[model samples]
Structures are given as C-alpha cells and as structure tokens.
Target: MSLEENATNRHGSPAHIQLPEQLSSKFIDRFIRLKTTYWNREYAIVLLAIIGVSITSQQFNTYIKYIDFMNQPNKTENFHLYGCLSYNLFGYMIGLIPGGVLATFYPAHNILGICVAISSIGHVIVIMSISYLNSLTLCILQMCIGTTMAVGDLSIDRVWTYWVPLNKQSIRHVPMVMYLVIFEEGYLRDTMDKLHNEHSSYSLTLFIGVIGLAWYVLWLYVINGNYSFGSLNRDFILFGGLNNSRYSFEAYGNSLTRSIVSDIPWKSIWTSKPFLAIVVLYVCDSRLYQSYYYNTDLFSNDVFEWTMRDNTVVLLLLVVVLVELFPEIALPISTTNVRKIWSCSYFGSLGIIFFLEVILGNTIKNNKMCQYLFKEMRHLYNFGFYVNTLDIAPKYASLLSSFLMCIHYYISDILWASVVRPILSFA
Candidate 1:
C-alpha cells in the first residue's frame, strides 16, 4: 500500500496532512511543562529581578562609601552623607506613585527598561559630577538614581504578580536577595577599603552604569521571549511595536466602567482596621530600618572599633546564613504561622542583643558575637516586613504597597534629616 493510503487507513488522516491547532497546542503544552523537574519562566524572571536588585544595591553601597571616602581628607562632620541619603528617600517619595501608575498602564518590562536607562544615566552624571563635587549637584544626581531604583523595585512586584504562580510556593525572595547583596557588597567594600583606593568610587560608578545597561538588554530579551505581552505570543520583539490590547488595565479588571464609577467603596478601605494597622506597622518598621542602616557602620566603627573586614565576616556568618536558610525551614510549616514565629524569634533575639550591647558598652571585646546579633536582627526585620506586606490586602496589593512606601520614605527622610544627622555629627 502507498504510504498515504496506509496512514489514512491506520490513523484516519494522510501522513502529510497538517492540523496546525493540534500541533501548536501540543508544542505549547510541552514547552510549558518541559522542565517540570528543574526550571521555568517564572523562576527565570525572579532570578533576573534578584540580580538586578543586587547590582543596584552594590552601586548604592559604592555611593555611600564614596561619600565617606571623599570626606576623609577634610574630616568634616559628614553632614553631606545625610543630605545624599535623604535625597534618595525624597526621590523614592516622589517616584513610587508614578511608578505604580505606569505599571498599571504599560507593560512592566517597558517600565523596567526605562528605569534601568534612567539609572544608567544617573550613574554617568554622578561620575561626571565628581569633578565639581558640589553638594547640590550630587544630591540631585543621587535623587535621580533613587527615583529609578524605586520605580524598578516597585515594577518587579507587579511583574511577579503576573508571572509567579498563585500558590504557597510563591514566597517573597526580597529578604534573601537583600542579605546576599549586602553581604557580597560588604566584602567588596572591605577589600576596597583595605586597598585605600581613592579612585575606586569612580571605577565603581562606571561599573554600575555598564551593569545597568546590560541588565536592561537582558531584561528585554527574557521578557519578550517568555511573556505573552498583548497577544504577540512567545516571539521576542522590541518595546515600541508591542500590541497593547491585552496588557491594558481594563483587561486586568482594574479599570472602572462608567456605571461603576461611583461604586468604588473608598470609605470601607479608609475605615478598615487591618488596613490602618498595616500602614502603621509599615511606618514604624521603615523608621527603625532607616535608623539602623544609617547608623550601623558608624556605630560599629566608633564604638566597637571594628574594621570593615570584621563587620563583613560577622554578617556573612550571621545574616547571610539566616536569611537564605530560614525560608527553607519555614516553608514546610503552615503558611499562616511562619511569619509569626519567624518574626517573634527575630525581634526577641534582637532586643536581648541590643540591651547587652548598651550595658556592656566598649568593655565587651566579643565583636564577633555583637556583630552577628546585629546582622541577624536586621535580616529578620526585613524578612518580617516583606512578609507582612504580602499578607495584607493582596487584591489591592500594588496600591497599598505604593502608598506605604511613599509614607515610609517621607517619614524616614524627615527623621534622617532632623535627628539622625545631628546625632551622627555629635558622635
């Protein structure tokens, strides 16, 4: 028998005949499930977000260290340091709302690309401004960098909403990423400090710009290839040519129809106890966090006389291990209780450590123990805050988050400007 005839007789279709829908469906299903044992697009996007945040954080550390290094010669009060840091908070205050709004209307990937571009431009400007070193100019550049970083940070949450599966498995990785970034960059800062390279700051800024550009390029490739942006399917393409039909707010049920314009029920949100509680919690946490971060290095150096290498080693042994490993231990337990247990343990331990440090003062020679306790506390606090943000109001999560961040940054900025600066100068 001829092949066609034999095929038709056996399978009810000729061998050469094509069923495009069937073939495409099969291919898509296989592609989605191909790496069931290992990886997927969701994991890829999360990893990219982690890496981008890491690079940006490293750059931030470089900026902080650069300011300190610049001030070493004059032995000034380091007031400019607070000014630079406050400018970052100010930028975050202004940028977060717009970032959240933009993410709602545009593809998150596009917004992310713009953020990275702005960050790169900010880094270049910082490098150029090094010649002048004017406080105003540096503050402005730092603010721009802060704006881009805040926008990119907020945008990542939205991207996760779309890409991450809605399951217990979708725990936030922000705490772990933060710990890793801080640990690695702390080591780098220590090494550079040891070298005593006055020019390292310039080199670090240039390096950050290059990394930002590369991240943007890689993001474009990965997002285009993996995400279904407005029915273009899996084909990778540039941003401008994207079809916006499917990615709109209306498609996502976030837009208000004319009939429902007056039915948004804003009063309930205002009066809701949980909502109010979350807002309060966020503010207090942010304030504490800002104070801790701004003072830790200064306090360690001045009080304990700990070198950068000692601090780095202590953090690596404590925070890095706890933040990276705790999730694994907690994941097997009930989701609702994980945050509670983890948080209580963290704060309780931290409180004890702080009391001991204050009472013992400089007489305590165990720098390693003190450093370990402080690092662990910082990590746990961050992890707890992150978990709380996710747990409250997931449906309006983006709005709640942006609002909380705006408040947090504004308050933190004021506190830093008014209280932290004077204290540091006096110390």
Candidate 2:
C-alpha cells in the first residue's frame, strides 16, 4: 500500500528492510534544528515574561516615593519610612526559602505568573487605600508585596534554568540587566508618575495585574503537554511537543530523573568552599551598594553641600552613563572567570574613587565624576556573583540565590546598624 508496507512480503515480515544512512542522519539533523528553533522562541518568551513582571513589581517603588508622610511628627515619619523599609527586606528574606521550595515542587511558570498576579493585585489594593495608610498598615502591605516579589523572582529564575541550555545560560542574565537599565534610565518613573498624577495609580496597577494574568495564560499555552511536569511519560527531549512513548531510551529516563533531584545535598552545599566564597563576595558587594543607595541624599547634603536639584541632576547623569555603557561594556563579557576578574578590578577601583571624591569634596566636578564611577562599578557584581549561584547549581539555583540574598540582607542590617552608621556619624 505504501513504500514501507510494500517493502514487506506477503507475511508482512519476510523482507530485509534497508534505509540510506545518509537520509536517516539528515532527517535526525533536521529534527534537531527544528527543536532548537522551537526552544529559542520559548526562551525569548521567557525573557519577555520576566521583563513584564519585573517592571510591574518595581513600578510601585516610584509610587511609594510620592506617598505623603509630612503630616506626621518627625519620629512618626521616620518610623513610617525606615521601619517600613526594614519590613520590606524582612519579608523578602522570609519569602525566599519558601519560594524556592515551591518552585522545586511545582511548575515554575505557573508559580511565576500566579505570584506576579497576586503581587500586582496587592499593589492595587494598597494604592486604592493609600489615603488610609498608616505606619503599621504600610509596613504590613510592604511585607506582603516583598514576599510576592521574592516568589515571582524565584520562579522566573528557576524556569530559565530549566528552559535554557548550559552553553546559552549567560543570556538568562540579560532580562535582569535590561530591567536595571530601564529603571535606572527613569523611563518607568517619568511615564508612570505622569499617568498616576493625571489618571489614577489604582487603574495603572490594575492594568499590570491583567498583564500578569495574561502571562500565565501564555505560559499555559507554551509549556503544556510534553513540556511540563505532567508529561513525565513523554520522550525526554530538550524541545517539547512529542507524544510518542514507544522507545524506552535509558538516556532519556536518566535525564528525566536528573532534572528533579529528590534528595538535595544540603550539607555538601553549605560546606562547599566555592559557595562560601560566593556568599562572602555577594555580601560585601551588597553592603557597599545598599549603604551607598540609602545614604545618597544624606551624603549629598552633609558632605557635598549639594541641593536637591543638584543631587537629582547627578543621579540623572549617572543613569545616562549606565544606559550608554552597560550594553557595550557589560553584556559582551561571557560568564567565565573573566566575570570575577572584571568584578574584582572594578570593585578595587571604588576605593580610589571614593578617596578622591572625599579629598576633593569642595570641587563639584570631581565629586560628580567620582560618584558616577563609584556607583557604576556596583553593576559588575550582577554579572559576576549574582549569576555564579545559578551557574554552580542549576537544579537548586533559585534556592541558593534566595538563601544567599537572605543572608546578605540580614548581615547588611546588622553591620549597618552596629558598625557603618556609627563610623559615618563620627566622620
């Protein structure tokens, strides 16, 4: 009836069937290329989803800046601001472990979408009730927002690890870099603030929530059937959409098992030298960056004798530099030992810049230039230590990232309160 059937005898099994080896190989190669193309599209969508959620979650930061706390007493105002800020970090720290654990047990795309949707909804509620917000209420809302953001962040990070191959793993960092670049450029702040002032913050926030739901719907379409956890019986291939299960390939079985490690080696991970080194590097880098960010206005006022407009101008200039240089300078650097090399070199230069800025504090030009260079160096940490956690342990990448970040937050709080603040006050 057909070529394959015609090759058989009257018994349907008496003939020796042969196929051209070249033809078979060509067919396999073509399938592989098609699969690669499919996965590349999936990866692009993953990055797009990441960009969407990150922007929505972070948009609230600008709105929070506009909140009126001037009516309260000085002590009350300070508590509302600083206390709520601490609650945000605390909530994020608490969420990280649970978020990572949930991602390990469930579908990452679902988790990301749901978490972001909930976060956006939460922000909408908070913004709707902005007039009723007090210190306690604001703190509670911030903690809730922080927890959801942590979960969303973990889910996206975990999903990419599952979706992307080792050779192309570095591209996973691009979404985050782009997020930073966009926010630093003040595009979101300028546009969203204008919308909020003209229309309403609640409407804007609700729109973001709708987008989050759309992300979930898109994920369901993209990763259903053979790609998700429910398709364990399907062929274990990098690309999805296969339904046949006749072949019992041991390699496929092994790979499927490897993807979900039932037993995580916690003891080995904690005691590992590389893990400890990465933790230390990240902690130190975060401490410097956080301290600098929180103290910028104070430092500008006290040390530089700069007005608010001058400080804002300095920030805008710094953003311009980041926008122009980040892609050209940071994106091309492969995730290799060179990441560490560049990070260390840039970090070391900060001390020199800081010294010069402080020594020549009276000169506005020197102060502005030094401040820009010093702040720009902090971005190198993302290219280096931030991605190192994922590179070292892809299966537990979210878990490890959350753990390290939690530790950094805790340590930063302690060191800032006990050591750094006192030194700055004395100086």
Candidate 3:
C-alpha cells in the first residue's frame, strides 16, 4: 500500500528507522537547554536597557512630581507650550523607517551604539536644563530630547525584531516596566505623600540620572555590542581600506542604502493591509502614552484632588502592563483566541474609566472623597492594559493594539486639547 512497503516487497527487507530512547531524550534535553540559553542572553541585554532607563524614567517622574507639588502656572503651561515642538510627534512618525532600512542592509552593533550615543546626548541636555531651569531653554531641550529618544528607540526595536524569538517577545515588556516601577515612582503614593515638601528631590534625581547614564556607556562595551564583530567602520577607519580615506566607510553604507532603497517600491505599502494595521496600532498606542504623560499634571492638581505620584506611579504602570501580559504570553494557544481576549480587556479598561468618571461626578461632592474613588478606579483600569498586552502576540499584538488605539487616541487628544483642556478642566 505504501511506498516503503512496495519497495520492501520488490527488493529486500525494509530499512530500520529506529531512534533510541536515551538518544532522543538527550537530544531533546540539549535542544531545550540551548533554547533557554539563547533566551537568557537576549533577555539579559534587554534587562540592561531597563537598568539604563531607570535613571531617566525616575528623572521624568521627578519632573512630574515637582510640577504637581509646586502647583506652578509655568509647570501647567509647559505641556501645552511643548506641543509647539512638533519635533517630538514627528520623531514618532518617521522613527521606525531608518531601523527598517538598516535591518534590510546590515546587521551589526555600530547602528545600536550610534542610536544610544545620540539618545544619551538628549538625556544629558535634559539634566543640564533642569539645573539651569529657564522655561525657554527647557522647551528647546525637550524638543532635542524627543528627537534623540525616537532615534534610539526605533533602532533598539529593529534589533529586537531581528534577534528575539517571536513567541517570547511579549515577555520582553516585563522588563520594559522595570523603569516605570523602580525608577519612575509609580507605586509611591505613600512615600511621596510624606516627601512632597522636599523640593530637592527633583534636582537630586536629575544629578543622579546623569551620573548613572555615564555607566551605561561602559555596560554597552561590556556586552560587546559593537554592531559587527569587526565593526563596519573599523575596516575603513583604522585598517585603511578601499582608498585609505577617512570617508571610505561612507561609500559602503551609501551603496548598500542605494541598493536597498532602489528595491523598495513605495506604492506597495499602501496596498498591504497588515502594514496599514501596524502603523495604525503604533500611532494609537503611542498617542495614549503621550496623552497619559501630558495629563499627570492636570490629574495631580490638588484642586482636582489627584496626586500624580499616588495615582499614576511608575510601578502601577509597570504592574498593570506586566502582570496581565505574562500569563497570556506564556500560554498562547491560538492567535484568534488571543485577539478575542485582547478586545475584551481593551474595551473593559475603557469602560471602567468611563464608569469611574460618571460615578465620581455623581457621588463624590467633596474633593477628598473624589480622590479616593478615582485612585481605586485608576488601579483597576491600569490592570486592563496589562491583560490586553500579554494576550496578544507582540509582533502582531502590539501593532494591532497600537492601530486600534491610534484611531481613538487621535480623536481623544484633539478633542481633549481643543475642546476639553479649555472648557472641561476643573483647574
């Protein structure tokens, strides 16, 4: 009936396809060990990113806290005024393009280092601006900071996509929360409540952040993260190749770029549904994050009776994002199921916030009472996004969420900025 049986009947006896139990187990065991090792190494590198960002995230939190505690008009105006720096938003729009280009043409550490070094310059400037405290200077510095942050971020994402296993990528977000939790002061409503009077916390945090980043440069070197083993630049820069010129390396990158750029047809992108969805997702998710960042002050206003440190602490952000994502990622069975669960949670989070707002408006007359009500509600909703992230696959899951979020995020931001900020704000 089968080819093997026919061959055996026509010729001699069938060939034995025997695998020993010990050999099979040993082989499987070795494979499992190798996979674990590969995962650990990549994870360790990402953990270092968490460590490096901890200082910066904390500094950003300190800024949010300072604005809240001081309750300054200048501090409130900073968010709206900073919006004039369209450079920050523009950075997000085009951020992923260069990374895509580099991944297509080259795979190495030089690109990574270049991205980090440029971003570090942004951090350095922010720290410097804080020490100086001129409003105009701060706004300009914020614009520069946004540019470098986008550049560095897009570059890091490119590397993650290329090297990390698609299945395990969702777990990557757990460490992503570390900066929010440990460094950003997400869960410190109690501690921060007691320390609100101390103005030095903001200045001291920035000073420490600058010193901390100085060590990230060393961490990069320790990891041997130089893009290429023999960096693309070294061959032309130090070893002297293709003409013994300083700009020789430029030719290599340029030629590679030209070849890649020429191959890509611009028209095909619009026709691709998956690509469109991804862009939508990134736009939406980033918008929510930006809105959230902009609102800490309004929410923290004692007039509104919400404390940013207590309400939106970095740990809360980290926990809400991570706790839910971990189990879903670990037990993924089907994409369809993941999508269903994701939609449920996404909508659920939105619903909870809406319900909380309505309840706060109706039941709580006293500002103090409203604060307690909203604070509990905030914690509950934060858990929703965490569940949403973990249930979906990162490559597609994050992109999908970003796309859907983008639609509502834009509508909300425009409405909030144009209509709500002026008319509806309590303060």
lDDT of each: 0.60, 0.61, 0.46
Candidate 2 local Cα displacement, residue 28, angstroms: 24
Clashes of 1: 0
**What's the CA RMSD of model 2 in angstroms?**
13.2
The digit string of per-residue lDDT tens for model 2 on 352-416 reads 65465477653324356655555445544456666677678776777787777677767766877
Give the higher-TM-score candidate: 1 or 2.
2
Can you give the lDDT of residue 57 in candidate 3? 35
Off by over 4 Å in 1: 1-38, 60-86, 129-139, 170-201, 226-247, 250-275, 287-332, 351-374, 377-385, 391-396, 411-427
Q: Worst ten-residue run, lDDT, model 2?
A: 239-248
lDDT of 3 at 36: 75
Candidate 2 pairs with clashing backbones = none
* Model 3 stretches with alpha carbons more than 4 Å out: 1-39, 59-112, 115-138, 167-206, 225-270, 275-332, 352-427
Where does the lowest 10-residue lDDT sum fall in candidate 3?
A: 238-247
Score residue 94 of candidate 1 by CA lDDT: 79
Judge candidate 3 against the unseen true structure and give its global Cα lDDT, from 0 to 1. 0.46
lDDT of 1 by residue, 1-427 (tens): 5766766685566544546766778666654553451266666766776567656655666677777877889998775688889998788777887776565456665666677767776776786677677778788878888887877777666555555633433234443335444554355556545544655766766777788778866776676663444544332344422436434555545554431343324577568776776666666566655555564553445334335435544654454344333435545677546555655666576566556657876422356666656555555455454545444543344455676787775765676679977998999
C-alpha RMSD of each candidate structure in angstroms: 11.5, 13.2, 10.7
